[model samples]
Target: MATGPNGSVLVLTNPHDVTTDVVLRILADRQVPVVRLDPGTDLHTSAALTATYRTGDQRGTLRTPSRELDLTEVRSVWTRRPSPFEGPPGLGEQERRFAASQSLWGAGGILASLPGAHYVNHPWNNRAAEYKPAQLAAAQRSGLLVPGTLITNDPDQAREFATQQTGGVVYKPLWNTPYKADGQAQQVWVREVRPHEITAAVAACPHLFQAKVEKAFDVRLTAVGNRLFAVRIDSPDLDWRQRQSLMECTSIAVPDRVARSVSAYLSISRLAFGAFDFAVTPTGDWYFFECNPNGQWAWQPDSITDSIAHAVADQLENGPEA
Candidate 1:
């Protein structure tokens, strides 16, 4: 539906993202008033901001090339993965750092305070939901079956946990961040960890260990509002993501219980969207893995992709669900 002239949807993400490309295309078709702003790269480049404050309240406007979005009339804000906040043009490292911090509190504070705007996943809520431990607890509480898991920085704890799990244990990174190795970016992959291999080096940082879940397949379930789009991935590898080329993806219906559990998780996490990963065993049971609150969906089939885009656009244009 075309948005009325009074309100606008603010899409926050980088330009190169395909997910942004597709969503914006749909919003364009719907004639939704959208301000596609990449706060990081656009703040000092093509964007300008102004605000007025009363003793207890604040109001603001953000001007992009084609639009001046009324922050007060913003229906929603969809924050994807934007680039890091660039401080100012032609500035030194320390000076840039200071400016970025100021920008984050200054402009960011006003945006976050927009009274009527529905955040797909509020920035603060998104950050909190990203933690592995936090997500696991929410999934468990939401009634999804989760594997035996442990988080520890002690080598002895890691050894004792691994020895108790019959199917063996695997070490998975607590967070997904690339590391520089030989001047190239690399990520740690999930691998089996034998109790004998546990060493004092495990104490260097927090490590996530879980009982190995032998699975018939994996599910990439992307949820937008109340809709769940599940794609079953059949792969022989320990991590299907490690070898996407060999994995076969097929659309599947989510079990009613699974759907309800995910919805409950979204409520507990205070999120409007989530991309969940589940391990499906041969006996047709599902085990909770993790959920990416701001995960990608454009890679799925056009049916799923377009549906999610439209669902997201609907929320942005129409405000919160009734």
Candidate 2:
């Protein structure tokens, strides 16, 4: 592993991230300096930044209530789940919009532009990897087994595709975006859908439908750097994420074929870390579904979670390969 620039491991995330806390704990034990900031909420109230450029050199400082950090000293940036920028508190509608734009371009750009610091799956890379279409194309190119799939806005095509699947089709939200239901955030989980369920409403926008695998179980594989930790999840539900309590999790090794495919996929996607979901058939065929560039891993079994956290800490502490 190569050493990064000298200074703190900068963590840009919401204050309440349990996944981050695990890595932070290990970094703490290793006595690595860290400067945590939530740009969304803190930028307006508690944080300030200044950068100067002269004589073809750039230097800056980040000031927060608890710490003052030299911007150039950011060794690596973990842009983990940072919320959208929330501008100043009392601005009117027009002013708020303007402030929001300024903050995004100003603060967000600076963070993205740090001179010698490496980003753990940089924000731009994360956004690109989030697209299911891109992931599917990349997976196929990398030689990962992929289920028969379709993304369409035409109801007729959706119906035709669903009918062609012998094991039936499943509907999955392309983004799994949060929806407000009864004043609480809710998510639509993956579920089996009939051809009739592909109604005209699906024409309202693009819909992702896939041939449902009669999977013996699902695999959640967490890749940190070149290390992969996979957990086999056995569940009764059509979508295992629907009910985690009923999930039977056991650590599993990555198959050589799958490992090679994933490595190629990550290189193609320019991601240092990713959480991949796959469906394993009865005969041990692993089919790639999607890769989350900055997905959750701490929710896995304890050993897997701890090992991943340590791997992440090591990466942040030592930076990427030179």
Candidate 3:
């Protein structure tokens, strides 16, 4: 097998990531060098990285327990859910914060600046696509059907918009925030808005309200470079994630129009991988919901997981197709 300079598959993710574990196994089976780093734990603890630039050329090395990876020699980098940099344990809050900032820009920045290394979805690109409003706007521009949505901190405006939609509206957080109720962790799920539920508290923070699309099922399209895998998900709950055990997922074919839009969305977002969600109406029309640039895919069946793992490994081994 032909290998790149450093010839290593650098995977940046926490240890709990099953997706990364599966991909690592595939790369190993194929005899590709694999290096796993958890920035949160390994950055200043078990790993060391150094980057030097001189005469307009940059070079670096990343050393972990098992191997040393030449930054310039890396074939591809899989940037997954790396934990945030946390400084030493003994420092005060303010001092620790300062250290974290330095570590992030120092270590994280160098990783992001690796030359000739293909990032599965570049960290910058992943961050750019994280905004829900921007995702919706891009989807619409790509000729995908998007729900009529409103983002505001004005209760009056929110209520007015909710009343305007014939089928009623649903409220979703602009971004997910961790919450706890009665000492138990909870998540804010997309929920249909009741007429009486609209209140002045909506003015507290910016909220996203959209005309709820009546859908028979949800479709999750996982795009790996140019390969798109569509799955039909059926659930009785509005937010299927809340009741994953009750959901039935089946692999399905991507519609031509939807596929084109998916391509356009990825191009516009400058992302090589995206996990897209859609609401499929009874008539089969797909309404774009959002695309998670660094979304999870391990929960899928072996067929889907194997396909995704192969696609990712192929990209890492040979670099992205032109």
Q: Model 3 residue 36 lDDT? A: 89
Cα distance off (Å), candidate 1, residue 32 = 0.7
Write model 3 residue lDDT over 165-246, tens digit each, in one string: 9998999987888899999999999999965688999878998999999999999999988899888999999999998999
**lDDT (10s digit) by residue, model 1, range 71-170:** 7778788888777776987999999999898888887777666776789878878889999999999999999999999999999999999999999999
Top candidate on lDDT is 2
Distance from true location, Cα of 30 in model 2, Å: 1.0
TM-score of each: 0.95, 0.96, 0.96
TM-score of 2: 0.96
lDDT of each: 0.86, 0.89, 0.88
Rank by lDDT, highest first: 2, 3, 1
